[model samples]
Target: MRASHAYFLFVGTLLTAAGYGATFLLTEHFRALGGSEIDTSTTLGGAMAGTLIGVPLVGWYAKKLKAARMGAMGAVSVAAGYGFLALLTTLTPLIALAGFLIGLGWGIFYLAGPMALSERVTDQDRGFWFTRFGAFQMAGIGFSPIVAAALVEHLGLSTRGAFGVIAGATLVAAVLLLTFEALSPQASQARAQTSNWMRALPALLSSRAIYPILMVGLGACVFSGMLTFQSSLVRGTGLEAGTFFAAYAVTVVVARFVLAPMINRADGDRASVVLLALMILGVVTAFGLVYGVPVQIASAILLGLGYGLVYTVIQTQAVNDAPPEHRSAALTWFVIAYFFGIFGFPVLGGWLIVTVGIAGFLAAVLAFAVAEMALALLRGRQTTRKPVSA
Candidate 1:
């Protein structure tokens, strides 16, 4: 990889680690502050709410600003949020504000980083680069708990202190992003010519990009449901709570790194079908089969291979399908759809688990997986009949 690409990936990895590290520790931090369960949930909800608001806002501005600069601004917001989080002692609206800042920052970075990278690379190499970027992202998420543990256990820092450290790291990321923008070629900074997104919405939604957006949303539902409730699902299955996570993380990193070229070379539509099927099999193995460690691990591997590879494929498709001028908008909608499922489905999953037990939750997840598979098939057929515009 070029130095610029490598630097961009490193920055992405660092930002993700700082952002997700704080997120993983949020509950513990709130509880440490003597906050109630409701406070914790509400605070987290604030973050999700902020992300829902941020995605579109960033998308709108993406056309006007350099993606790297927007990402830097996002990092600043995240740092500010974390800095606020470090100083809080009581539950207040400030807590929500902090969460919102963090979420909004992440929302911007999520869209901006990919947008920037996509613009920098060619279509032929886009899938490989995206897969690598995603691998780094997963690595960040997977290793954050370890970093937090080191800080708290070895460094003798409190959870709040860790937030302070994370805040510093995020600021560093912001600086690096600015440096990246300075060193790279300047992209258009002119304002968008369109009056507004609402006027262009009909044409944008009518494109083949919708298929990947829908697939991503559905895929997020399955991914979140499985990960969020893995512990609950395995409560009595003689499995460790971290089993799925560890296995899944390792599998994703390996699959994305090792299989990216194959994915790049494969036919997009057929690959999506097969990959989505693997995800369904993973879900079935985890929830439907007799609960055991081997089965659980197998399920994790399947999910890792499936979702890990397919995400890059479909995301590339989402960009590839759009008109050049609308690529950012397409990606904007794609990220929004993903966050909606990531934040929205867990609430529904929690309700189902509470109302009708784990069976109900598993059934709902399966339905999503099936629906996603059906959509992949539909998209494949549609593409065959009418190839997506270049």
Candidate 2:
């Protein structure tokens, strides 16, 4: 793997750190501005809605754009959003525009980052780079809040000032992306893949390669909803939310090193079943945490063990099974499905909470999970029968 590839990805992702972190801050920002909870959700949802348009474009243009170039484009979008936010004093509809731009860049940057890594290294070394990819992403997420908090608390930096700093950093990242040489001509075209994703969409979705990621939609929904709404919910069960999440993140990172290799050794079909069962176990067990802290800790560990490798397994399956020429497009589709779960179901979950209560919401999540398992089983059967060549 090229060191440059890793470096560029780390820097590229770092540029978006504030955008992701801003969502959390935006809630309080909106509240401080006298906006209702509904206003916050709507504003945030507007950002997520950008993925609806952005992801599909990424998928369609996967063949045309260099990953680094795409990342550069994303960086600019995010920086623009940051700049716009930095200039804001009062609430305005323009925040949605800024949010939308950021969201667009989010999809494009992620799509580019993975493909760039793929281009930089040999297949034998792909796992190392992919793991690193997650590490960098996690590092950005983990670092952003800490840094932003420090800036606010110690340096007396306003949120706008913090965003300005981030915006400057993002522009530098974009410059680096525009000038990078990691992607060769062939890689630039993803080996000259098909030009029309619209025609290919139907087959891509029907293919067994897409099945694992489809199941991931369910998992992403749970992850998104939990973090967005229920970050505090576990506290009611006698678990400190921070402690539980810290445990979850630690186990996830650790499992990538210790457990992901085993999943990789296993074929995609079997891997999906393993991941699905583990997530099911973890989520169900989480509800039982009212019994004790032991259960809380156990659930966190199990969830980390399960969800940690879930994406890796499905992502590997999707890329490996995709035609090499169209792999970028396939991965984009996979990512879109992921965002759908993250953005779509979380809102639905919120509605479910209001209508059916937490009990009903939990029931719905479980049912959705069961449906994912059934689909996984069906896909597993088909994939095992007709093994895909890597």
Give candidate 1 regions above 4 Å deviation.
1-5, 21-41, 63-65, 89-95, 122-125, 149-158, 185-196, 229-242, 288-293, 323-325, 350-357, 385-390
Lowest summed lDDT across 10 adjacent residues in model 1 is found at: 186-195
Each model's TM-score?
0.83, 0.81
For residue 380, what is the lDDT in candidate 1? 84
* Clashing residue pairs, backbone N/CA/C < 3 A, model 1: none
* Candidate 1 lDDT, 1-390, residue by residue in tens: 366645754565566545754565565576678864345445556667878887777666766777778888888888888899989877786787887888788887887776667666666776556677777777666556557647877899987898888888888888877777677644454342222444555666898888899999999899877875665687666775456767887898898788867776778888888899999999888775355788988998999989878888888789788777777667677888888776567657656765788887888999999999998888887875332221
Residue by residue across 51-150, what tens digits does model 2's lDDT show? 7787676555655776667777887887887788788888888877877777777767767766666676776787776776676565454355546546
Error of 1 at 188 (Å): 7.7
TM-score of 1: 0.83
Error of 1 at 100 (Å): 1.7
Top model number, TM-score: 1
